[model samples]
Target: MSASSPTVPETDPVASGRPFGAVDVTWLALLGLTLLTWIVGDDAALGLGRSALLLMGLATLKAVLIAAVFMELARRGRMLLLGLGAYLVVLWLVLWLILARG
Candidate 1:
């Protein structure tokens, strides 16, 4: 409470040195997903084309979860979310096109 110390609003947890709850959960989830992915890879989940598709789907889901929760994109403006969605859609379409050609 000294005059020399800058005062911050009590509502801002970041300013108070408290960790973000969501960040911890997101990190744990990411670690679990990474382990799952490794297990899937060892089991030859990427061997067949269909299995590859499933693996890709799982990876995309993990990416989305990490982006939304860890990156705090969900709380961002609608425009940012929309852009992310569009990028994902485009990536999906490109992958589908490439797979379909083979």
Candidate 2:
């Protein structure tokens, strides 16, 4: 997820020398990702397991965007990183338990 996310600037755009459109592009990307997740999750042909995996991936992507851009954690401490890692782990565990059938 972080692989696709843009690194947020540590300082204001004026100081960082980035254009104002960067924020707008991030906002649009978040919205588009959310919509895509919703659409893919609702596709019956994807079946349960595939839909779950795809949705989980999308959710992680959205989370990354929120943390890195909206929350400004690109250059922050490690707590946020730990929190996100824990969140994905828990999410995968729950999905495994629910999707795995003996």
- Model 1, residue 25: C-alpha shift (Å): 0.4
Q: Please write out the lDDT profile of model 2 over residues 1-102, one tens digit for every residue.
A: 569885654666755876664557789998999899889977999877777777887777777777776776655645886688678758965885587442
- In candidate 2, the residue pairs with backbone N, CA or C atoms under 3 Å apart (3 or more residues apart, or in different chains) clash, namely none
For model 2, the local distance difference test gives 0.74
Give the winner by TM-score: 2
Residue-wise lDDT of candidate 1 within 7-102, one digit each (tens)? 655634566677666677778888888887777767853555555565566677777776676666765555776677677756765675677566
For each candidate, give its TM-score against the true structure. 0.62, 0.67
lDDT of each: 0.68, 0.74
lDDT of 1 at 45: 36
RMSD vs true structure, all candidates: 6.5, 7.6
